[model samples]
Target: MAEEMKRMIALGFEGSANKIGVGVVTLDGTILSNPRHTYITPPGQGFLPRETAQHHLQHVLPLVKEALKTARVTPDDLDCLCYTKGPGMGAPLQVAAIVVRVLSQLWKKPIVAVNHCVAHIEMGRIVTGAIDPVVLYVSGGNTQVIAYSEGKYRIFGETIDIAVGNCLDRFARVLTLSNDPSPGYNIEQVAKKGEKFIDLPYVVKGMDVSFSGILSFIEATAEEKLKNNECTPADLCYSLQETLFAMLVEITERAMAHCDKRDVLIVGGVGCNEQLQEMMRIMCSERGGNLYATDDRYCIDNGAMIAYTGLLAFAHGTTTPLEESIFTQRFRTDEVHAIWREKEATEKKAN
Candidate 1:
């Protein structure tokens, strides 16, 4: 009764990339508020870490005020403060870390250093109610096939070079596509008008996928092909999306089979694509499994994911000391021991 009655709330800040977000969440899976602003670059350009950090510096405080107002919670109401610790741009990642540190000092609250990738997985799990599903985490910075094993989110497969979303973003830049909302989002929209299926490159080395080769080929030939009317921009977008999504699906399926898991959970920024979701759904259905997914609100980088995941850690008696709450740019998802998870698969069975 006491456990059920206890309510722990966390205020989280996320500025690991172009987006700066603030969110408030409770241990009971209640999201009081999740507000964010993205630092959108002009068409055909990507956001640099330094400029992105400057943007975050300009907007973090306002977003925090907005989040608190939206949640109707004061600093005293929060049980803990949370912020993403790593696996993101160094400059942008530090903005959130510093903000959380200041807040921790002011409010006298404990801090929880969250792994960004794990936050995405935990957010997907809570939103979709997926239990023990193989995770396909696709984003601008990461691409991985993950599963739970022995108290950890194990990486079964991953990208060898550029991420899947990075491929799409660069392709969009090559075509001079708009980045108003996002390059990947625009690519998905343009791909809908694509009729021809232009083959580029298919690279799958074991469970790892490589997008750099495919992207480089596209970059070299997209202009020439478009100039010669060999393939429309839509066709190129379509073909690129198809190849990337297919590679992801392939690795995810292999992980599922290897893990003997029947459910698949898609997470991260690129996971918001409906076409990718449908393809994964079909694959899951064919294998008599389930596909768990969330929309853009949860899939994209946001503070609620950090808050909720942090609350989970806090509830598990996990806290980050002030001196140890520093950020990094290369924290792997598999490095976090998911102490909140009660049950884990002991080992992978032989295939």
Candidate 2:
């Protein structure tokens, strides 16, 4: 029977946080279609969780429709549906969860709730083909250093409070920088034009990291310096980038040392930073190790990675029963059982 051709199609929903990204991916790791919908919280919105959820609800359907059209696939063609399980806004996740559940029911297929962080890691692997690399996820709400251990994905280190991207966004907001597209983009532009590095605290707790303190220190310094005419925005931008990227790279290097792994894979929105990528590449090269990253297609929020990971999960026969499945606000990466390899092995044996 040739093991039923080992075929599968997955539709991924990523309404976690602010990005309403959707895509269709195939079992061969090919991204058939991807569409992204981005929303920026107004400055005075105060990080209201409910507001973020509403934002996601408004954009999910349109993004999904575009993705399906781009992939030239219909809902009926999807073998399963996948969504970010947790570590995101309750309402936003619910929006995606509800959509996935309804779609699964309509298509008479299963749903696979995936960990957002794990999806990032798996995407790195798929794009870069880096086996067992130390993975770093730096995004709006997360900063984690992960390595696969035993039967679980182990978090060797992570943010004690705020994530790296959050720090940059908050700082950009304080300066009243543009948020039309993204605050990160403005910060990166400023950092490039800047010539000096304003001093900022580097907080590293063993393997764990804390960016809140650094963010606060930078804000205070900026205010005091502006009053005393001590620093400029360009200089401040340069300094902030240096400090933040250094802290991230340092911990990643330490993780590599601790794990004795040479391969490093970085994912998430912040992973798009060229400076950070350069730093990691230098560190990896210095250690005679390899480093991998994705282009904007996979780095910035997109559904392709989710769809890819979902395809692997579905192919391995790991699925969530529609009735019992629900969106999770605190899904952990290690909770996902690794089934990709096993499923492939079984298929080969059967053949």
Candidate 3:
């Protein structure tokens, strides 16, 4: 193992979206320090790409310094530098990549380009110690049910349109809720006070789910409620959460069933939802399985996950050449080859 040879330290930069995160981790999956800064737009205002990019640019260096300080490590101590490469907003992703390039040149260290979604899955697996569990990855820009097969993280299901977190954020904007901490957290709080279950469209096509219809219906419902005072915002939030989370759970369960996997792992920004976790726990209980999840610290886009995943890739001889260092906005989860999981892949093939 890399940890046995020497202490392998990796510095990770993650600014794929509105949040700018930096962290340091070792090869053994020990997170030394994880720090992040988020750009919170005003109510009813969504974060623009350019603005989010600027936010990352403004805070990336400071966050990186803070991470290094907290980890009690200097630049020379890092064995490698890692950054989020794709499956995120282009401008924000560029901010992370630019930082990575500058750091690699300054510190004279190798660099690893991490897939944002795969990083989340790897972090979930590391923290939960979940061996070969079906992953439910949900965030503002993505929703996918992933599992390992044939040396790759295969996507069994995904969002056809808007993601589950995007649906909730747009609805929060319609309601003019505070975006201080997070829109989804505010929605969850309001949802707890709700008693009525307003009917909302639930779209699940085979193993995939769509949130555009549900988002539109909720937005219209919020407007109608404003005009007629027919239902409380709490009730709308409650119903929305119920409908969307149920759709996610349904698709995730289907993936688990098809894979015949007993363990269910939830990762990403939306995975921090208590209601979603509770529902997943109930589902797993029924199947006599287990549910694994992390808190917002790891679940949300952070550098720790990136660092851990990068360590794994580095151990497997994966490195991004300086000339080829680039970011993509639409990198699929299945496109990544899980070289570190070759053992698991071979075992699955044998079985």
Candidate 4:
């Protein structure tokens, strides 16, 4: 393991999606400050990439300034600049990258490019103190069950289609729900009042799950109900949550079994759902295991994760040249070599 350093600091920029977050962190895992602004669109609408990018462009600098002020650190105090380099929307990724480049030039500090998914996993581990848990990553853009082995956070299973969050958000649009706080949050609120659990398609293939079919089925059912005045939106929301969360919990359990890991850590935006967490807790309790998950703050994508994970890389002598600091839209989680975990993995294998 890279020996812990004295007072290493990093500033992170996150704009891979609708939210733009700026954060500062220390090498010892203290989150100095994290601030974010989300770009919420009107009801029955999804945020466009171009508009989201524009929103980031407008607010990133201000958020960064706020983060610095909150963290009590100036640009000169930062050891390095970090930013999400990808597995996200290209335009938003570019906006963050541009900010990082400008900041690096101004501060004359090294740049650390972080993989978005890896950042989530690392942040979850840090906050929850989960050691070698089977990770269930569910978010707006991605879904996968992951575990660490060899030199990478290996993908044990993944979504064959739309992610769970995407499914929920699209369904919210169908219901003309506000996207302000979050479409999923609105669904959750309405789902609380739902008494009926309408049957919906459940699709799980081996270790992987597919939500596109489930989404299509529920959407069509919703439309039919709308035409005939057959069911309330709350009922649909309840049914959707039950069905989808069940699928996630099932796959997560399968992954836990396959890895022989008793600790399960849920990361990503959809991981914040209380229904999903309750189901996971029940499954873990039944198996005599444990579950670890962050609240909305850390579970959702944020600059703190990017900064913290980048500090890990920086501690181990990882740096990105200006020429190589470009963003990517398809950076897979398994593609990242977890150098920070090398010592920990080696020790576990030996023991």
Tens digit per residue, CA lDDT, model 2, 25-130? 8776778888887777665233556877787778888888889899998878888889887768888788888988888777887888788888888888888888
* Clashing pairs counted in every model: 0, 0, 0, 0
Per residue, candidate 4 scores C-alpha lDDT tens digits across 186-272 of 999999999888999999899999999999999999989868978899999999999998988888899889889888999999888
Q: Please give the distance, in angstroms, between residue 211's alpha carbon in candidate 2 and its true position after superposition.
A: 1.1
Cα lDDT tens digits, model 3, 1-351, are 534634888999998899999999998889999999999999988999999999999999889889999999999999899999998899999999998999899889999999999999999998999998999999999999999987789999999898999999999999899997999999999999999999988799999999998887788878887589788999999999999999988998999899999889999999999999999999998999999999998999899999989988997789999988899998888898889899556767899
Arranged by TM-score with the best first, the candidates are 4, 3, 1, 2
Question: Which 10-residue span in candidate 3 carries the lowest summed lDDT?
Answer: 1-10
lDDT of 1 by residue, 1-351 (tens): 546525778998888889999999988778999999999998999999999999999999999999999999999999999999988999999999999999899889999999999999999998999988999999999999999987889999999999998999999999889887999999999999999998889999999999999998988778788889998999999999999999999999999999999999999999999999999999999999999999999999999999999988888789999999999999999999898784223232322
Candidate 2 regions exceeding 4 Å error are 1-6, 42-47, 341-351
Per-prediction TM-score: 0.96, 0.93, 0.97, 0.97
lDDT of each: 0.92, 0.82, 0.92, 0.93
In TM-score terms, candidate 4 sits at 0.97
Instruction: Give the Cα RMSD of candidate 1.
Output: 3.0
Count of clashing pairs, candidate 1:
0
RMSD of 2: 2.6
* Local lDDT at 109 for model 1: 96
List of clashing residue pairs for candidate 1 = none
